[model samples]
Target chain A: MDDFVYLKNVVTLELNQEKCNGCGMCLKVCPHEVFGLKGGRAHILNRDNCMECGACSLNCPMQAIFVKSGVGCAAGILNGILNNTEPSCGCSGNQSACC
Target chain B: MTTFKNPEKAHSPYILDFVPTPAGEVPRVTGKLKLRDVLGTFMVRWSVNRDNYRVSPGLYAIGDPTDSSDVFVTANYKLSFDHLRKSIDGLNAWILVLDTSGINVWCAAGKGTFGTKELVNRIRMCRLEDVISHRRIIVPQLGAVGISAYQVRDRTTPAATATLTAGSAGSTKPLKLSFNGLKVSGGFNVVFGPVKAEDIKAFIRNNYHATREMRRVTFTFSERARLIPVDFVYGKYKLLIAFALFFVLSGLTRKGVSFQLALEEGPYAVLNILMAYVAGIVITPMALPYLPGRSFAFKGFVSGTVAFVLTLLINFPGLNFPEMFAWFLIMCSISSFTAMNFTGSSTYTSLSGVKKEMKVAIPIQLISTIAGLVFFIIGRLF
Candidate 1:
C-alpha cells in the first residue's frame, strides 16, 4: 500500500483539530492507515492514501473529520451522468455485478 | 452432494439443521466448505448467476453456543457469509446477518444497505437480546463506512432499560422492545473487526485486537486477476458490434463497396480489434504497477501502442500506410478508454481522482476514435 498511492492532494478529507476529542476512533476504523495519533489527536498521516470511504468521519464522536465520500468508479460516475443522479456503482436495483 | 439435515429447507444444501431459539428457529451452518460451495464460488468468480447468489438473511448458529457466545455480524451475500462462517469454524457463535441484497460487505456498506439503520432493524427483528447475553457485536472493518458505531449505540436503547412483561414472572416470553422512527432495543457495542474474515480467529485469540496489517486492503496479482473474467466478458457485445461494423466498412473501395476486398481484409480488422481488447482488458491490468504512468489510460495507451506495433509486424505485407495509421489511432483509443474504465475495479482510486482523469481522457478518446474511423474510411474509399 505504501508503494501504491493514488493522485495527491485530491481527497476531500479534512480534520478539525479543535473539535477532535482524541478519541482515536478514526485510527481504529480506517482501512488504510490514513489517520495517525499525534499528541493525543487524530492527524491525516497519508492524505493521498485516503480513498474517501468516510469511515473515520462516521465513527468520529465529535464530528471532527469531514470528507465527501462516494464511489470512485469511473463507470459509476458515467452512470450518474447518464441517469442524472449521484454516482453509484449500480449497486441499487441493478442485477449486474459491480466492483 | 448435500450435507443439510433439515427436511423442510431441503432445497438449501448448506444448512446443517435448525436449532430452536428463544425468538425462533435459527439455521445452523458448518464451517467446512463442500464441493458445491467451491463450484458456486467458481461460477460467481465468472459472474454467472452473480445477482441471484445470496443467502437468506437471519440469525444463524455456527456451533452449539451459550447465551454469552460472541456474535459476529455479516452481510446476506452468501460469499461474505460463507467466508465469515468458514473463518470462525469450530467456534460456538451467533451470526446476525443483515440484508444487503446479495452484495459483499465492503461494496454493500459503501451503498448503505449494510448501514446503521439496517443493523438496528435486524437486531430488533431477530430479537438478539433474547438470544445473546453479551452486548457486543463484531463487525468487519471494511463495513465501517456505512455503519456509524456511535449512531448504532445511540439508536439502540440498553437492554437494562427494557420494560419487563407483567404476566411473565418466570415465563419464556422475549423482551418486548418496540422501535419507532428513532430508537430500538438492546444496544450492542460495535467492535470493528479486521478487514478480512480469515483473520477472525487471530483477532479473537488476541483479545479482539486487530494488527495494522489486518486493516489494510491489498490488490495483489491474484486479487486483480479474479476480477478479469467479469470485465473481459463485459466487452463481448461491444466487440461483436465493432467486428461487424469494421467488416462492413472494409468493403468500401475507390470503385464501389466491394465484397471480395472485405473477404480479404475483414479478418485483419477483426484481429486488430481483438488485439486492442487483449491489450486494454487483459495486459494493462496484469502490468498495472509495472506500466509507466499512474494514469490507467496512459498505461493502457502504452500497452495498446505495443500491441499496435505487434499488429504491424504481424501484418506488414498486407497493410498500407493509411490503414496502419488508422488502426494506430483506433487501437490506442480503444485501449485507453477500456483502461480508464478499470478505475472502477481498482481499490486505491478516489472519486475526485477518477473525475479528474475522466475529464481529460474522455474527450481525447472520443476524438481519436472518430478521427480513426474517418481515416479508415478515407484509406478504404479513396
Candidate 2:
C-alpha cells in the first residue's frame, strides 16, 4: 500500500536468454523475485527488484547471467566516491572492512 | 662483501634514514625473484637464498638503508609488502614486516591475529631496538584496534609507535600525512569508497543460489502441485467446516443466516487477504524512497491509504455514498495492515525502530484485519 516509489534507475543485472537453459537458478537465487519461469525459460519479470547481489551468475552452471554487483547502500557508495576507492556492500566474500 | 647503495640516490621525501646495523651483520638475499599477481593488483612473491628458505612472510631490509632511514611497518604477507613497496618509488625505508597469518591489516585486525601482543613480539624478534636508533615505529592506521599506543609504549623499552594511512604513506607533504591520520577517526571513517558498492553488486550477480532460496513461493507452489484426491478431500473438509461454523455462529448470535448468505461473504474475505499480501510485499520495497515520512510505519500507513482508495474506485465504479463509505473502512484496514508489515526491509529503520514500530503496528494490524474479516463475513451473510 506504500505509495512512495524508488526512482533510482541503476541497472544491476542482465540475462542472456540465448544462453539460458531454463534451469531456474536465477529465479531461486534472487532475493527480489526478479525472474520467473515463462515458456519453459527464465525471464526477468521485474528487473527493478534486483539488489545487484550477483548470486545468480555465480550459481549459474551455464553462465547465462551477468551483472554489475556491489553494495546498493547509499552511504557505502558515497564513501567510495569520496575516498576514490571501490564501493562494496560489505558482504561479497568476508573481506569486508565494514560489516 | 655487500656494498652500500648511495643514500642520496635512494632519497624520497616520504622515506627517512633510521639507525642501521653493521654492513656484514645485516642478512642480505639476492636473486631474480618471481612474484604471483594475486587479487589483480596485489603481488605475492618469494626470494631464495642458499641454505635459507624464505618463501615470503618475513621482514627484510630491501636495498641498503643507512642509520636514520625511515622505518615502515607492514604485514608479512607478500601482497601487503608488494603494495607498500610499489608505492615508494625511490624511498629506501627499513621495512618492518609483521607475520599476520598471510592476511591484510584490516581483516587481520578484525580477527585479532594482528593484535597488540603479536606486534610487540615481532618488534622484539626483529631486534628493531638495536637496528633503529630513533624510538619511533610507523604502523598502519587500520591496525589501530589490534594495537594500543599506550600498551606498545609500556611494553617496548624506548620505541614509540605512530600510525600511518596505507595509501598516503608515499605522500611527501607533512600536512597531507597529518590530515590523513586525522581524517580516519574511526572504523567508519576508513576509506572503503565505491569498492564496497562494486563488491556488493558483484556478490549479488555471482551468487544466484541465494536468490533461488529467497524466491521460492511455498504457498502458491503447494496449491498448484497437490493431486486430485488430496484436493477433493480438502474441498469436502472446507465445505463441512464452513457449514458447521455458519450454523454455530448463527445459533450463538441469536440470528439465522441462509447458506447462500455465508457463500456471499467468502469472496470479500479472499479479496482483503489478497490486497494485504500485495501491499506488504510488493508495494513497500518498490516504493521505499518516496514514502510520506521517514518513519517506515508512517510510510506504510500512507501507502495502505492510497491502495484502499484505489481499490474502492476499481471495485465499485458506480457505487453510491452509503456503499462507498462502508467499503472504505474495510479497504483502509486491509491496506494499513499490509503497509505495516513493510518494516522488515527498509534501510533507515534500525533494530530498535523496527521493534518499536512492530509493537504498536502489529496489534493495530491484527485488530483491523480481524475486524475487517468479521465485517466482510457479516456484510455478505446479511
Among all candidates shown, the one with the greatest DockQ: 1
TM score of chain A per candidate: 0.93, 0.76
Per-candidate TM equals 0.91, 0.30
CA displacement after TM-score superposition, residue B211 of candidate 2 (Å): 30
lDDT of 2 by residue, A2-99 (tens): 22223234454678888888877566445456688888788888665554555466546577888765433432343455677765322223222221
- What is the TM-score, restricted to chain A, for candidate 2? 0.76
Query: TM-score of each model's B chain?
Result: 0.89, 0.34
The prediction achieving the highest TM-score against the true structure is 1
lDDT of 2 by residue, B1-382 (tens): 1122344423322223333464224433221123432332221111111112112333445556665555556664544555556544245556666666555554454445556677677666666555654545555544543454435655663321233334567643212223323431211111111111112223234541122332332212222222112212212343455445534433322255555544554454345435544554356445656556644455656666676676665666444454344445545554454444333223122223334455576577667656654654454344
Candidate DockQ values, in order, are 0.67, 0.03
Candidate 2 is scored at a TM of 0.30
Residue B281, candidate 1: C-alpha displacement in angstroms: 1.5
Candidate 1 Cα lDDT to native: 0.84
